[model samples]
Target: MCSGGFAKCLGITLIPLAVVCVLCNILLFFPGGKVVESDHITDEVWYSGGIFGSGVLMIFPALVFLGLKNNDCCGCCGNESCGRRFAMLSSILFATVGLVGAGYSVIVSAVAIDHGPKCLALEDGKSVWTYPFNTNGYLTDSTMWSKCTEPVGVVSWHLALFSVILIMGLIQIALCAVQVINGLLGALCGDCCGCCGGVSMFSYALDS
Candidate 1:
């Protein structure tokens, strides 16, 4: 099938998602880590954010290197450069995707963290509720642990923070894999194009 408008639409939608996913991953890790582990969690956050954002979000702009370009002309000028549109769209999609991860992290933390002590503590004037952090690092309640009477089942903000960090870490690793693919694509395609078809073209914008 002919690839023109489809690439155009994809360039617009997909590139932004790529960018957003990077930010989303970072947001998810923060509240949970800060509330639970405090300073202890910083290293993990920095590590994961760097891996995902740099490994993934950083390279996401390269997506434009792969796809087609926009055929439609915009603005008052009737200039037609289809490849240029693809580059922009791929960049937008990658950036947007990078942010989606961050967005999910933020929203999930907002809700899940409500159960956390820092957030719950704000209610105040009641019992000081403590949630049990698991080896998995998920926050539940300590009562859940004592019932099992199992060894090595300690729970605390540290565990909870670690859990979120772990989740984000796993995601960052995955993003790294994706970035490798994009990186390869970038290398194969390079940044050279009569118009620089997909998203990688936007890299110039960032450099500027």
Candidate 2:
């Protein structure tokens, strides 16, 4: 497949993933699917990692990738093949942006998972909204989840949403990584599959 075609596929795949990440992050604000005071929300939800990092930031690259497949420059100053190559080259920069954004989401989500949920928990015989798990091992210990007294099943809820963000972020990272190489290949070698009169256009672009 032409680099542009592959990029288009990646772009299509990224859109839904980005949307899911955004929704999951938003849901994190309301722990256990119930409305809570702003102060009660987990600190990590405020980071906007999924909303900005994985969602908004990813949209740029996805759109660019989608447009690349139809990039035509018949009336433009440059050769069409050359223009296509340049567009592909430019996509690499956007892909890098995607990489950074997804990486940020992954990091934030992972940290949030490790820290567990902030909920009303017993502290000195008083219930206060706070992170109950001080140790990493709490994730595996279902009995320990009872520490969060106010938001019932909050530990599981927190784990599910953040885990989705983490997985989606990793997928975005992989897709962007693929696009980096694909973009480089597209830049170095004109998109042969999409070129009409094949070798001539590819050769002409290289010769110019």
Per-residue lDDT for 43-78 in model 1, tens only?
334444433533354344334423433223351154
Model 2: residue 76 alpha-carbon error in angstroms: 5.7
Estimate, for each residue in 1-208, the C-alpha lDDT of model 2 and write its tens digit: 6888999999999999999999999988889988999999999999989999999999999999998888854413658878888888889999999999999999999999999889999999998988879987988889898888877778888999999999999999999999999988888887654444575778898999
- In order of appearance, the predictions have TM-scores of 0.31, 0.91
lDDT of each: 0.40, 0.90
Residue 171 lDDT, candidate 2, scale 0-100: 98
Model 2: lDDT equals 0.90
- Report the poorest 10 consecutive residues by lDDT, candidate 1: 146-155
